[model samples]
Target: MPAERMADFRPDAAADVTDVVCPVTFVKALAALDELEDGRILEIRLNDGEAARNVPLSLKDEGHQVLRLTDNGDGTCALLVRKVSACPVE
Candidate 1:
């Protein structure tokens, strides 16, 4: 897939959250999710196995949504996610 399509990344969109290019900090990123306003979409870059899998899973578990991901061959991948409106706004 093309990087743009796979990444599902749109830098022009409104951003409420972002993180260092780390997978382990995904939980930390989740914790900071509330800081995002409802209906906001955030883009992230992740590298390595644990994060590529965990971040998406964690977002789902928290009731947030993983809109899409670009699987870069290297450890780095791009993610597009939206915060759930139903979750309490932080």
Candidate 2:
């Protein structure tokens, strides 16, 4: 899907990890994903630099769809992800 549509996309679930650091940020996002159903969309709010970089990549690596990322212009970004599998591919 187009990146702009992500802004208007209504996710099945949403999470905020802007208060946390890396690893933990992705951890929380993963945990949230764990609770979601397949084909569901997750909207995650994360810190700008590391978490922003890593979480989406990790999700993609795990076979999920990293749909879109929008910078909030405040050291944070919103990530839209679609759950493609029940568990992460390890």
RMSD of each: 5.4, 2.2
What TM-score goes with each of the models? Answer: 0.63, 0.85
lDDT of 1 by residue, 27-82 (tens): 55565565787667767667657777777887877777778877667667767777
Model 2 Cα RMSD, 1 decimal: 2.2
- Candidate 1's C-alpha runs over 4 A off are 1-24, 85-90
lDDT of each: 0.64, 0.88
Q: Report the C-alpha lDDT of model 2 over 1-90, residue by residue, as the tens digit.
A: 565655676799999998898788888998999899998999999988889899999989888898888899998898999988845347
**lDDT score for candidate 2 against the true structure:** 0.88
TM-score of candidate 2 relative to the true fold? 0.85
**Which predicted model would earn the best TM-score?**
2
lDDT of 1 at 33: 60
lDDT of 2 at 43: 94
Question: Candidate 2: where is the Cα deviation over 4 Å?
Answer: 2-8, 86-90
